[model samples]
Target: MISRTLETTLNALALYAIAAVLGVAFFDQLVNGELPCPLCLLQRAGFLLLAIGPVLAVARGPRAAWYGVTILAGLAGAGFATRQILLHIAPGDAGYGAPFLGLHFYTWAFVVFVVAIAASALMLILRQPDGEATDEVQAGAASGDALGRIGILLVILMAAANVLSTTLECGFATCPDDPVTYQLLTPSGS
Candidate 1:
């Protein structure tokens, strides 16, 4: 019972964190008119992928597979963020995108991914299995609960918002190498 609860809470926390950050990014783009670069878009995709694990955890209860998803997504995002950081390592190179609270968005993304990995690892290590019958019952019951519903809703909303924004920014193809503005929105051949 305790393990299940802990896993559920951790999953909820992860989902909420991802949503909050995405919300901030959305507002920053909508209100500030700052367009995300291609790498930033990739990092956003990573965050969306990372959220899948937590959403699964909430909907299906604690499972190793869900945690595995989080770990893999986190590592991928971290790698991309690290590469971007290295690109700006030279003196006065001005990192890609705007900095938030003294750190670039990619830096924050790297930190979030690392933290997700750590949290998922801890959950995996600390999980104590209930009997199969009890687990099945709990998972089924939990799936219909309020938190699970909220998790599903958030995932849908975030995914929809991301798809819309990406479409507006990149249209039906790949984004530019260093997108400072919306490509699809611009006049043809500009």
Candidate 2:
């Protein structure tokens, strides 16, 4: 029974939530000096792509197309996280990167990806009214202007943060495949 405006707002909030989670991870990396591995970077890419869904939903109202974008991005992120998890399946293995609260970043990334998929699916379901198509699809996006603005702002901030962190981590070039330390800080670019 949710209205399109409400649904759009919810999607915006969900996107912001995902951005916040990634922000926390970035902070953790900065604090602990933990350079992200290849899989971790891939997961970050997935998250960034998934975040676009909310902005689109807000800009155009609730549409299955936007949710589809989220779902696909989530699946890609989940795959990356799962691959990283499998790398350390053996007992007594030190695992990649630093662990947050005893769980690695990739593990958290997996959880976030699964949540994204679920949220996108739910939004898609709620977008339909009484199990039929409705005019909400063509409704004015201006109704969700406030939420849309916030979503767009969050996207900008997230992009800037990622750019800063990535630059600091890898400098003006590509990051190493399995970086154990920040490339910019390492002597002779080891």
Candidate 1 per-residue C-alpha lDDT over 67-186 given as tens digits, one digit per residue, 9 for 90 to 100? 899999999999988988888989999887678999998899899899989988887777765344345565657667776677668767987998888888898877877766676788
- CA lDDT of each prediction against the hidden true structure: 0.80, 0.76
Candidate 2 Cα misplacement greater than 4 A, ranges? 129-144, 172-174, 178-181, 185-190
Task: Determine which window of 10 residues in candidate 2 has minimal summed lDDT.
Answer: 130-139
TM-score of 2: 0.84
In terms of lDDT, model 2 sits at 0.76
Q: Show model 1 residue runs off by greater than 4 Å.
A: 130-136
Alpha carbon lDDT at 170, candidate 2: 80
Tens digit of per-residue lDDT, candidate 2, span 1-190 = 5676577678778767877877887787778767776678778888888887777777766667878888998998999899989999899989887778888888988998998899777776657653244546534455357766776787778878887777767877778877666666668735
Tell me how many residue pairs clash in candidate 2.
Answer: 0
Q: What is the TM-score of each candidate against the true structure?
A: 0.89, 0.84
Candidate achieving the largest TM-score: 1
